[model samples]
Target: MKLARLGVLIDEAAMKRLHSYGLNVFERYIEEILEHAGAPFETITDIRALDDRGFDIVIASVVPENEETAERLWQYAEHGGTLIAYGGLGLLARRLGCRQRPRTGAGYARLPEFRSVPAPLRCLSAQPWHAEDAGAGAIGALHASSPQGELVGPALQTFAVGRGAIHRWAVDIPTTVVQLQQGTRPVLHDGIPAPDGTADIDEGILKADDDIELDWEWDREKTATGMPYFAYPHADYWREALMAHLVRCALAKDRTLPLLDYWPEGTGHVALISFDSDFNEDERAVVTLDVLKKLQIPSTWCMIEPGYSPQVYERVLAEGHELALHYNALEKENGIWSLEEFTRQRQWVQSATGLARVVSNKNHYTRYEGWGELFRWCEANGIAADQTRGPTKRGNVGFLFGTCHPYFPIAWCDEGNRRYDVLEIGFLTQDLNHPNLSDTTVIEPFLKQVAKVGGVAHFLFHQIHIHRLEPVRQAIREVVGKARQMGFAFWTSKQINDWQRARRTMRVTGIDAAGQVRLERGTVNEPVAVWLPTSEAPESIQSPGIVYRYGVPCIKQVHHLTREEAEC
Candidate 1:
């Protein structure tokens, strides 16, 4: 069977905002989601030439560039081409079963078919539209809370044209996903009120968690510890739903797309345990190391100033654990948030540990000030991964930053929305057993949701807690055990950074008309997983670099293939 090809139509005007905002939700950000899904697609700017190219399905990420473009899209759908309008359908409003709603207010949206998980209605402000029910059935609906109480209307709907259909999303899926992932620009200081004292909001520094837009009541669920728990990754869910719909459209056209598995060896998901080595407590480090040794799992130890003894560092290296830097930018401990301080501390740790380079870092107390300065410093210091973006308050635990997936952040101050060399691996919460922070109740749900979203479930533990608190120790053991039972492999921060960077280079070179896919990767130190959607298992397979294959049941039938670097 032949696989259908997809074309992503983007507004060049909207993408121009990348210069100021670092990224535009409707443009580069949406493309990132599609790339991660491993869906074969082409970006088209000229809608006039779209009819000539053989694209089975088209995603109008832009609200019709002009009248000609809008007419062309409607004709394409009428002539048997699947068209998915991301947000604004402009001229095709009445044709696609939607009437413009003249109102702007705060609201929440839920897809009943998708477990009724609620997400903020972003499209209402962009282009408010309600379903007309003129041959189209609503797939999802939104409840807008204005001064006039609440108004319920259709949020998502699909209707057939001549031979094909058009699926419209009123929530501006791309914008919502991007906002959830990157968060808003921290202009001056605080965004969310930290009444729990987890952070000193009045300090006038914009911490990573401060940029989070999740509402305490609307986005989080109540926990056993009475803390606000973010069980659902609204952004990732939107991305997943968008991709699932695209895949279904392709399948309807007798096509299949390839997807890159999140973990190595076809692992369902991954979990990472990291420690902030506060005050260089070598004795406490030993106790934590003992527990990890008992479990035979490697961990990442972030070294603060005046780190552990040389012997302890040697032991950590010998035990296959990673040694990383814990940057302290707090004012109380004579800390300074500056590039000079970062370079100084980075140099001290590297010299003390006898290492030429340190690959990872986590800030002390998650102290952040500016927007992209931390990322710039990381790139300058050659640090590949940073784990500071997470919930400092117990109320913000679980997907606080809207993702567990590590990604290279775009330099907000840089031109062309250029990405930094550093990959941010945002932690979920600090010290699960901490009374003022989090508890064990979130472990199972957090890990499960992360696995569903196919990202790392990274948790932070301080050496001080591990040494002083028995509950913390037990919590660590339980979390690791549960993750293992759920098919999650534990990995250190360095390992994750290495694997993710290596896999980023892997590209789908081509997919033939006969559904055969060709992939290309640069020289990598480890093997990567590539999955292909198939209706049936192949009796025999022949592909270089792929050393093993496994059958894994998912939303669809897929064969998981592990592709290793070929022998030189």
Candidate 2:
């Protein structure tokens, strides 16, 4: 459907409570979810200024201070508007036909449809208030204990209004928002001793076992039915579930529009074969490059140091592969780098490669502390994108933000909730993470998931690992073959970054009363894919650089044009 106009009511008093509770109070995570879902929204602090005609859906987290505010919200819903109220908003519950009781002890919940993999949600300390009304339908079932306990009540609910509806999430939405936005869990201990037991690898460099394995389980039935399985409790699945609910609410109000797809040209999925050049051996790097060349895959090579073999860089460029910076600082003390160091190192690579700019990078050792500053540094230094959003620990591999697609990160620490200029390409799978690299099966499930969602299949491989370990090479080869078989379009990191940048700025300017669609080109010249939800496919289509593909739904793409015209 057409992008839904959303409005979030900000309650100052609710902010105070959330802050006093030591939970994250920002709405940036919600905005990020909307942006990725292609739903445009605005924030409203003054309840009087809210216009039901303006927003198709309105979300509020605080209880109304007086009867007037509650009456206004009730009137809006009565006029066929969607209202989503988070817990702690007792007035909203009564208006939506539910009775909110006193808060209960900490517990867990089972959200089956909320995620591909249904994980038991452990609502520590801030257990949701129990609902006492029979009209409230359960969205999630609560457990009495932490991990697994006896059934208690509904953790989330929905109730019907006059001509609209209200979705009440019993648990704390802000807490989940904060956890998803920060992307990093609390550092439990001083350090994790390496397998060899020589010394600890600093706390932030790798995630603790508890953080990685958060009691998440795969849904066997869903898997058997060929549904995508995203690891639950991971930020991505939660974000996905939240957005899906929001979209469902919007669609319930109106269902005559089309939803946006992540990729262009209606491609099933995109693949990036990346290699981190962290070692000192030029021969090893060359060997890995040879393997890629033989596979006919255009990969991205992230160089760790400045002075790599000139021949290697030259060959990479000549073979149509991309050269990117792998910003390296092996020592724990150097987690955050100075802007001067960033500029100098990036410049050195640019000078050697003879390219005007180097847009892609992955931090050495995956040192991701000070990410907000690092991304700002990337923008300042003209770096267009980064792939350092992966989990710090090697053994744990999954989406940190619950997506395999590239997105502009909402500046977590920035005021005014601004977004970063640099695009974040989520890491899909890595070579060094697995105990045995020969087990090509480690990535099969993930690849299948990405393909199911038509997401980006980003694969990170260390050149040294591939050169030293035969299994690593075999694994890469097998994965590459599998992706090709699955109909994934192979791309360099820069290509993915460029396409995402263009898509982010692209917009639908208008649809005339006569049903003609108007468009505006984004900042880039890349082709844009326009997905139109239609009941029946057009017999034939006519437009420059535009192609129509029919499936359960169909999408139209208009490419290489500053301006174009189309009819649905």
Best by lDDT: 1
Cα displacement (Å) at residue 510, model 1: 5.6
Q: Which stretch of 10 consecutive residues in model 1 shows the poorest summed lDDT?
A: 547-556
Query: What is the model-wide C-alpha lDDT for candidate 1?
Result: 0.72
Off by over 4 Å in 1: 11-14, 17-26, 45-51, 62-64, 94-97, 103-106, 114-126, 131-133, 145-151, 159-163, 194-205, 225-227, 411-414, 509-518, 521-565
Evaluate residue 199 in candidate 1 and report its C-alpha lDDT on the 0 to 100 scale.
42
Tens digits of per-residue lDDT for model 2, 30-109: 55555565445677766776753477788874434677877888777777777886565566665555555656665566
**Clash count list over all predictions:** 0, 6
Error of 2 at 469 (Å): 2.5
Query: lDDT for model 2, on a 0 to 1 scale?
Result: 0.62
User: Ten-residue segment with the worst summed lDDT in candidate 2?
Assistant: 213-222
- Candidate 2: list runs displaced more than 4 Å: 1-5, 8-24, 40-46, 61-68, 86-88, 94-127, 143-152, 171-178, 184-234, 332-336, 391-394, 413-416, 432-438, 509-568
Q: Candidate 1, after superposition: displacement of residue 71 in Å? A: 3.7
Error (Å) of candidate 2 at residue 345 is 2.7
